[model samples]
Target: MLVEFRPHARLRGKQPADLGASVLPVVAAVSASDTDLGKVRVVCDWVQYRNNFRDVVQLRPILNGDLEIAVDVRRAADAPVGELTSALLRQSPDRVYLEDWRPGRDSCVWRFNALYWSALDLWEKATGRGYEQALPGGESDARNRAAAAELIGELFAVWDRLAASAALPDELYVIELGVGNGGQAKVFLDEFRDLDRHRGTAYYSRLRYLMCDYSAHVLDLARETVAEHTERVSSFVLDATRPRTSLGFLRYKAFLVYISNVYDNLPTDEVAQLGGRTYCVHNRACLPGEEAAELAESVSATVDELPALVHKLLRLGPVLLAEACPDHFADTDAAVRFWQDTWAALRLAERYVPLAGLDTYPLTDTLTGEALRPLLESGADVRMHVSNGAVASFVDTLGLLHPFGKLVCHDIFVDDIQGYRTTFRGPGKYDGSVVNWVNGPLLAHVGRKRGFDVDYAPFRHRAGGHVVTMTAQVRD
Candidate 1:
């Protein structure tokens, strides 16, 4: 573990070794009576040394319970201030697993997952906005409007060609996977409507915009936002990963499947390349205090309980909530407040576990078992996203596109494998849920296997954001 001290900001210099060497300086700096807390970034890098993966454990305790530990073991670990390292050592982690797809918890804290989901539910109920909107200036959809307008213009160009050849579908479909507060959907639909009116193509009348999400609460909020175009709007409660099952009725019939900031929020597995071998890096979510630990345990007691809880909180109506938890309803408002508090207490602990082989690691849906060739097989030593949910969602969503239809997605995409090593992304808390950088190269590979032309570029609608625009179309 390399402990770097930045009393106010990060400093560059060769610091001394562990305890007395590094600890004494921090201790001396904080010896002042007025200073009670300070920050230290402890990065633990685990290199393949022996049969079992050995982590180089180093510590520079900054006033204890105030150290910022970032574990670069398996995947990049995002530890909050004041976290201790406790590895499983010999077994699978008890708390953390690869996240299952849930609309409300597309991303989750391995620790305090239950609290996180409950907090998100409480927040949506209280604010009618998602965690994305909780950030400053994150509530705006102007960039999406520009992106949507450009997309619509291109789709209309394709539509004109299709119509000239008499191949246009009577019902043109535009699907959005994660519709946050319907801000982007409203912009998209409004632009499409305006474009239709200007061109006098009557495309708006034939347009069927499907807002698919896992949370009914979220969908309800989307509906309220896009209420003006109810005539052409439809909503479905479906998993983005396995959209084929619920949206099978419209298979190969839809055009323009659009997604905004959805792929980054999906659940993904972390894989690492080391010593010419690929390994599945595993970590469990760990909370600090006993109270926070208990809250995490209560929420994730079962294997899939956290997702079930989130789904219940999101999909269940108020009357059903009253019926399900009759005892907790006496002080429903206070009960709801507790949910938000639990989410704020989440922290993560990570370690690298040597994989015997890549034989068992699940990569793509169709290409698994011995047939799977892990992307991390590259020569570089790096960790990256095995975005199972995003890939499955991309594959299944592409299946819904017509011959002329195109899939457009905007997200925080890691276009190169090298980006994972240098940049901070994934396995981190946003406001109430987890946010990860989607692996664009992996998605592009999957698209190639499926005979689709997949490409990525910087999000032209915005600058400085990590978001990349990914486009997929049927290859000739």
Candidate 2:
């Protein structure tokens, strides 16, 4: 049996074969790998093996004639070796393949992600709380008053320079994507107005603040929060990934595009360079047949029918789903409850396939996978999020910036390639949405290529957190 430990640095100075020796007895007794040999992989943890493992001790079939035995080492270590081995040896009696393992970006997890935003009202109403409550501090740091003041101060200086030259536009544009509860926007606009008055400038009156988000409910809530600045605020329910498609008129006009806790939530795929071969990680979302049957039974349905019901629930929110399937769901609340349960039990099965070539892989419509080679080759065996959606959004949003403008994002960012080796960078769930650390190095590389400077610094307002401030501006 082949064993792999992750963060990979976990086995520092040790051989894979040597580190796997503890399980040799279990392997010998089962002789599970005797027939398939290298086809069997014993994975150590879930952070790196999330695609392949869901439980403390579990087994999954990799489509390419391989078997995966996944163990949560942290949880499994306390159990008797025999008990752990027995758990491993147990066949997945009701396991069912839901989708062919595909790239992380294509996984069904994202469908659930989109559902969270589209159905935000129902989810929040049913749960009696907004999604922002799920954040680390039960709120975002993007609304920090001092941070907003500093940013507004900087923008004022830029506007001041242009005003002196008689080049300032009549309508100053500041677009904020992913406006959470409008706390950040309120802070920003409040500061901008205060600063403008103090500086004796007209920039505040000239400001056009656009609040954009995927959920109309979120936008509504944010709009209400910033009601005091309603005249200056314009809200749009646009997909964050395709902002340029909606804000095309603002091309080369926006002075400040602010994004916070957003890039990390966008869809991303993961790539790994191991043993000198690069591979793209693929995943499939599935419900263990046993769990499916149980969840189905709770809803008076069958296991085989669960997947379709789920797709329906995702495409149509619980109320519509309940109305459409009266036979299964007793009411909207029941349907919403079922949706919650299913999401909690959702699992992703993952595998790595050798990349045919980097050039053939598409990073975005404009950028190709070839752009990732340098980052992937920078260190030892490493797996990192491609941040596909984030990259597309970043590059496209840059086009919306005036040459003197800037884009500032506050989110989890992996500032150095070496950071990948030392830590677990997400694909973690934030409420019902997905979160992955934005690829800082990759973003910097593309920014420089586009004649922009991208830089990162730890978020200064908060004393302890992973949030970083990424600023992209035309290179001087």
Candidate number achieving the greatest lDDT relative to the actual structure:
2
Whole-model lDDT values for every prediction: 0.60, 0.82
lDDT of 1 by residue, 1-476 (tens): 23532221112247322333333333333333243344334443332112111222322222223333333343223221122232321223344233432222223442333334334566566657666664436753334677778888998999999899998878888888878778888888899999999999999999999998776767888899999999999999887778888899988887888787667656776765544555554543333345444654544344344434433544453335445655443344533543454445433344344556666655556645232254565545566777777887998888899888888887778888666665545555556555667888888887888899999988786667566788899999
Give candidate 2 regions above 4 Å deviation: 1-4, 7-43, 46-53, 57-70, 78-93
Residue 108 lDDT in candidate 2 = 78
**What lDDT score goes with residue 116 in model 1?**
42
TM-score for all predictions? 0.72, 0.90
| Per-residue lDDT of model 2, residues 24-112, tens digit only | 54455347434466667665553542332365555655545766665555444444544555555664435555677788888878888
After superposition on all CA atoms, what RMSD does each candidate show versus the true structure?
A: 9.3, 3.7
| Weakest ten-residue segment in model 1 by summed lDDT | 47-56
Clash count (model 2, backbone only): 3
